[model samples]
Target: MSPAKAPAKPVRILLAKVGLDGHDRGVKVVARALRDAGYEVIYTGLRQTPEMVVDAALQEDAQVIGLSLHSGAHMTLFPAVVSELKKKNATDIIVFGGGIIPDDDVEELKKQGVAELFTPGTPLQDIVEWLRKRFPSS
Candidate 1:
């Protein structure tokens, strides 16, 4: 008889709020949506530092890192997370974010290694689909 194969593991995504951003309604909604779509999500509650976020990502063995920022600190915070990930030799982890970021800032953030940025009114399904497409094996 042939041996049974193990089940495929669900994609692991770490969602976080960096800096002093306390408004978490949007992040919470994204978390729920991702979970409902069959992805394993780890949400580090409000007010996470870049260091805390990268560390959590490492500890969680996450395939993707999603930062929810609304404090207009994306220029500083996003790069910090990317730099920390590089320092730890963890650049393979995809970093993405969403919030009140301006168009010019979004382009620059992407140049700095943020995979994608979602603004307000971006459909939740779009985010879910993007993640699935970006990290298909995740």
Candidate 2:
């Protein structure tokens, strides 16, 4: 008989709200969805800086950092987080975001190293499945 398959790795994702963006409703919802989907989620409360977010992600040993922004500062905050990650020599930790980012800036963000960006209506299941695909078990 064939051996049973190994359990999939539990993806550890750190979710955060950076800078003066006080909005938390959406990030809270996403955190719950990811938890229900069986991923370890760390939701750092509102008013965090890019450095604080990166530091927490590192301390938590998270594989991914999910930043949610609605303050229209995606252009600044997102890249700052990515830069902090690079500065800390934690490039392996992937970064993703969701918010009111303009479509025009998507490519630039990607070039600056953001892995994905979900618009307002992106299905939670899509987020779950995407993480699964990104961190499939051996």
Candidate number achieving the greatest lDDT relative to the actual structure: 1
Estimate the TM-score of every prediction.
0.93, 0.91
lDDT by residue (1-138, candidate 1, tens digit) is: 895443288888999999988989999999999988888899989899999999999999998999999998999999999999999999999999999999999999999999999999999999989987986764
Query: C-alpha displacement of 27 in model 2, angstroms?
Result: 0.6
Global lDDT scores for all candidate models:
0.92, 0.90
Q: What TM-score number comes out for model 1?
A: 0.93
lDDT of 2 by residue, 1-138 (tens): 996543466778999998788889999999999988777788889989999999999999999999999998899999999999989999999999998888888889999999999988889989888888898761
Model 1 scores worst on lDDT over the 10 consecutive residues at: 3-12
Clashes, model 2: 0
Model 2 stretches with alpha carbons more than 4 Å out: 1-9
> TM-score: which candidate is best?
1
